[model samples]
Target: MRILVILRRVLDPAGIVAHRRLRRLFINREEYLIQPGDHSALEAALRIKDLGGAEVVVVSGQPEPDDDTVCRGLAMGADGAIYLSGEGFAGADDGVAARLLQAVVDRLGGADLVLVGMTTLDTAQAQLGPRLAGALGWPQIVGAWSVEIVDGRVRAVRRDGDDYVVVETDLPAVVTVPGRALEPRYPDGARLVNVYRGEGGMGEAVLRWDVADLLHPEGLVPLLENRGRDFPPERELGVRVEGTTEEVAQAVAEALRARLRGA
Candidate 1:
């Protein structure tokens, strides 16, 4: 079976967002951190690769598909990488982005399953995953925590509201993996460092995709815009002390009861 994993560039979530103080900075925004969903997708995709039965392919959005990026994906365990890069598609928003990605799928067209991160690092709206699936007319199992391939069918575990979910689907399906669903193996440094130096290396690895390549009109729709933001001052925290173990328990119970009564 062939599995295609869609990797994306994301801002690290642990980092704090900074105020855009420099006008010349490249794409600076107040929300500078990558969302958690992107990490989840990468981790999940990597897990599928490590399991060993399928050939894993990685795809990304860039103006030109880079050999270095492909090497990195290989280091992370992908068999190969596909970059859907170009000029007109550079500023495409999520909807437009989906159109571009769908074209990549059509162009690269041979896969039993396609896995994507739940959301991109920059945009946490979690829109692209499902949209891409819809555009491709594929069955999608969103927010899967775990997936197993058996006899060309997929058995996936997912989150459903407060409950968990498990579903079985046939091949040629698109599944959006949830955040940190599984651990992504560390890059194989020794092997990756040598992939480029090795014989017959990404000989001429590059794909130049233009918006005109797609069946859709070359229209760029803005996925997001900042109308405004509200800054709420941090609320002051307070602490209360209860006399003894018994007294503290009593106080907590009384407070809870009183709050519930009011509600």
Candidate 2:
């Protein structure tokens, strides 16, 4: 069995500072880490592999220097990795990525299962897995807490309202793991060194595939464009009501009525 995992990088939030008064963001430090959700997804794939000898391959569309996420996956235990890059793919949104990754799955000769993060940290976009599932015409399970495969079928634990339920789907399905679903294991130190140094048979573990070769450049155009960040206006101080309980309640009701009238 072959399992495909999607991984990506996100900016470390600790390094950024937002100034509401200035209406701007300041970068005191520039740092990146594997997306938390994706990290857990990788761990889920590794656990599956450990249970039943499945080949785990990780794929990423992050640009050249951002291949760190895929490398980290390899160090953590992925059997292979694919890095998708090109000028046209630099700014791909979820829609464009779904199409591009669809072509990637085709080129990979298809997979028995696909795993990815339920949402992104920076953008909070939870559309990639479902979009890819739609592109592939496969069943999809979102926000999975735990996953396992048996008898050519996949089973996962998902939240339904206030309860967690076990759901099962056939092979060749897409599963999106939540960020905190599982505790991600640390990368093997020796394997990480070998991967970065391109030694110990780790050099050939990663393959670089240009997006231009997989699909026409026209298809790489993003459907969404980022105009810029827009911060909300600074908040005004609240008026304090000083009186008895009934008076304060009346004051609150009046304030609500005024706000509702404005609305």
Candidate 3:
């Protein structure tokens, strides 16, 4: 069985500062880190590989010439990596990415499973996995905490409201893992250095793919465009109801009723 894991890079939040008073964000240092959710997904994939025998491949759409994210996946025990690049993908949105990824899956001769992050760190957008699932017409299990393969089926532990439940789907399904679901293992030190130096047989593990060859220019056109950033207004402090229990309950009920009426 072959499992494909999607990885992405995000700006390090520790290197940036957000000012509510000025309503602006400042980047003190330009550094990138693997998306937290994607990191967890990678860990999940690696765990699955450890359980049995499965080829794990990592794929990324980050710009070329900088294969840091994909290479890191290689050092973290992925069997192979695919780096996607092209001018048309510069401003590609989730919709365009979904199409591109769909093509990648087909070009790979298909995979038994596809694992990815439940949401992106920077945008907090949870559309990619669902969009890809829709594009591929595959069943998706979102926000998986644990994953396992049993009898040609994929089983995962997921949260339902405040409860946890086990859900299973057939092979060739999509699974989105939450950021805090698992702890990511450190990359192999020697492999990490070797991958960057193009030595120790790690150089050939990365394959560069041009998006143009995968899809037409028209197909690369993004469905969404970034206009600008909008910051929320200053937050107002909440009212405090310090009284007897019944009085506090009454106050809370009145507040909710008022809010509902206003809505």
The candidate with the higher lDDT, 1 or 2, is 2
Q: Rank the candidates by TM-score, best first.
A: 2, 3, 1
TM-score of each: 0.72, 0.90, 0.89
Q: Where is model 2 more than 4 Å wrong at Cα?
A: 235-263
lDDT of 3 by residue, 1-263 (tens): 99999998999999997777789989999898989989999999999999988999999976546788988899899999989998897888889888999999999999989999998889999888889999999999999999999999999999999999999998899999999999999988998899889788788888889999999999999988899877777777977899999999999999999999999
Candidate 1 vs 2: which has more TM-score: 2
| Model 2 clash tally, residue pairs | 0
Give the least accurate 10-residue stretch of model 2, judged by summed lDDT.
Answer: 61-70
Q: What clash count goes with each model?
A: 3, 0, 0
Q: Scored by Cα lDDT, where does model 3 land?
A: 0.91
Strongest candidate by TM-score: 2
Candidate 2: the clashing residue pairs are: none
Q: Tell me the tens digit of each residue's lDDT in model 1 across 31-123.
A: 322134544555566665567556777766654444455555666656666666556555567788777777777777657787877755544
Output candidate 3 Cα RMSD.
3.3
Model 1 collision count: 3
Task: Please identify which of the two predictions, 2 or 3, would achieve the higher lDDT against the true structure.
Answer: 2
